[model samples]
Target: EGVAAFVASQGTLSYQLEHFVDSHDLLGRSVCSMGSSGSKYISSHEDSDSAQTHEGVTVVDAGTWVSEPALWVEWTHTGRLESVGETRIFVIDAERMFKALLHPGLRAVATQYAGEFHKRVVTAKPPLASYPSDIEVPHADFCGIVCCMAHPWRVQIGMHAFRKLAAAGGFGTGIAAHMKSRLKHEILTGRSVLVVSG
Candidate 1:
């Protein structure tokens, strides 16, 4: 279940969940276009081991597309939704989540790894910074209170959700681990700050 918001004709922001459908219609589809072989995009099914079908994928632009091989995770949608003012929050099914994250554009490594081997090997490509350090944040003015906020309550709730999922084992652990690492880096470096508004 994923959350999405759209403005209704009446100019009201409405939110809804992309409700999960327990279908394997897209189970074995090849997400990458280079060739018709490699890891199949994840499905709604719980057994990721059973869903994997190994083949070969020809990496077109290996230098830029290849990323370090890692384990693909499968998670169940909790089917829960939360509303915080104008924000509606929900968890997406593993299939959609993995598809978005493991899209070829993000992880371009030509070779795919399976099982425990994924953990030991790292990509030879040098890491590139996503953005330049000296970039400026554009300022915008709103005549009224445009209450976009980074509420402490929301942060705590997100942290708690990650922790809960992580405790459930499997892919959640990876998600939590990555989230923690990124959060710590941001806090220590002060590279970005969440603005709180009353």
Candidate 2:
């Protein structure tokens, strides 16, 4: 999602423009000519230095001109793929698909609505304007979501699922006990807990 947003913002174009301008030598030829001509117009006595610099710039500048177009084409393809992947993920996850389509800053409301939609008791669609108080707060953006999936609302949801699994003895007692405690800590502090797996 973040990559799609960044590419959509045209930041890649801005970066490429800056890179081109910095690498292009505006005075390379004339400066090099002055070295052999000993032109009075040129003030610097270091003819050898200027010629050497011009030679290097010519190689680098030519390479930049040749490579940049191909790189830009590659990046365009990459950005498109990223955007496509983001769209597909949203499509498969009905809840996130709905949330992504909602007005900016209303992600929490969208999530609440999707939850209601999934309820077995919901025979008809709920009103769009009203949502449960528990989900009134905004949810995290992409990076925040990656850093911690344990948003307060998500923690509650996980707790419910975990309890069901525990009752079914899906996990060993010690592992389940440890996870239960961790969930409690996350809810109490409203912070992410890292769980690394090999």
Candidate 3:
């Protein structure tokens, strides 16, 4: 089945199972453009009749455009032409492709083999530091507190209803637990705390 049909029937695509297939001409052309020589790298003994080696590996910057669903991955290469050759673009389905890109085993392998490839390619240096400066400022003071005062009777009745519900175990205990944990964590972390005061 086509990807669209599969997605519609399954309600979601398993990004992990996606694969890219390219002809040798295309692959060589892409690699050459990147200024790198292209050759299948495999151990001699590892090649077996039943096993398909490197069938599922997705190549980035492969000079392929995906127009059906409307997606593409931007890419670039760094290094001299002698060291690193051409950079080709690869088409990708953005939303559905993230799972494939972020697969656990693939992530570890990419990290090790690619050697900080993620950081090298994805990291952006912090903006240049600005020097501290002091200048006179116009005096403008505006202070206001939003005070919502509920009627005493209404507050009492609401509290009474909450107490009854809690006592009966009819209230959502999970939500309360989560809130308590969050509040405690905030307090321990010395973060600004906002309380909904009744």
Please tell me which predicted candidate would have the highest TM-score against the true structure: 2
Which sections of candidate 2 miss by over 4 Å? 1-151, 164-170, 175-188, 191-198
Give a tens-digit lDDT track for model 1, residues 1-198. 122211111111111212231212112211111111221222232221212222321112211111111122121232221222242222223245445666563333211212222222211111321110001001111111111212332343334444554465724434666676786455345443322221
Clashes of 3: 6
Compute the lDDT of residue 197 as modeled in candidate 3: 30
Residue 75 deviation, candidate 2, in Å? 16
Q: Can you write out model 2's per-residue Cα lDDT over 39-107, one digit (the tens) per residue?
A: 111111111211222322211110011111111111111111112111111112222344466664346
Candidates in order, TM-scores: namely 0.17, 0.23, 0.16
Better of 2 and 3 by lDDT: 2
How far residue 58's Cα lies from its native spot in candidate 1, in Å, is 46
lDDT of each: 0.24, 0.26, 0.25
Candidate 3 clash pair list: 33-86, 34-85, 34-86, 35-85, 35-86, 61-88
Q: What CA RMSD would you report for each candidate?
A: 21.4, 22.2, 22.3
lDDT of 1 at 162: 41
Q: By TM-score, how accurate is candidate 2?
A: 0.23
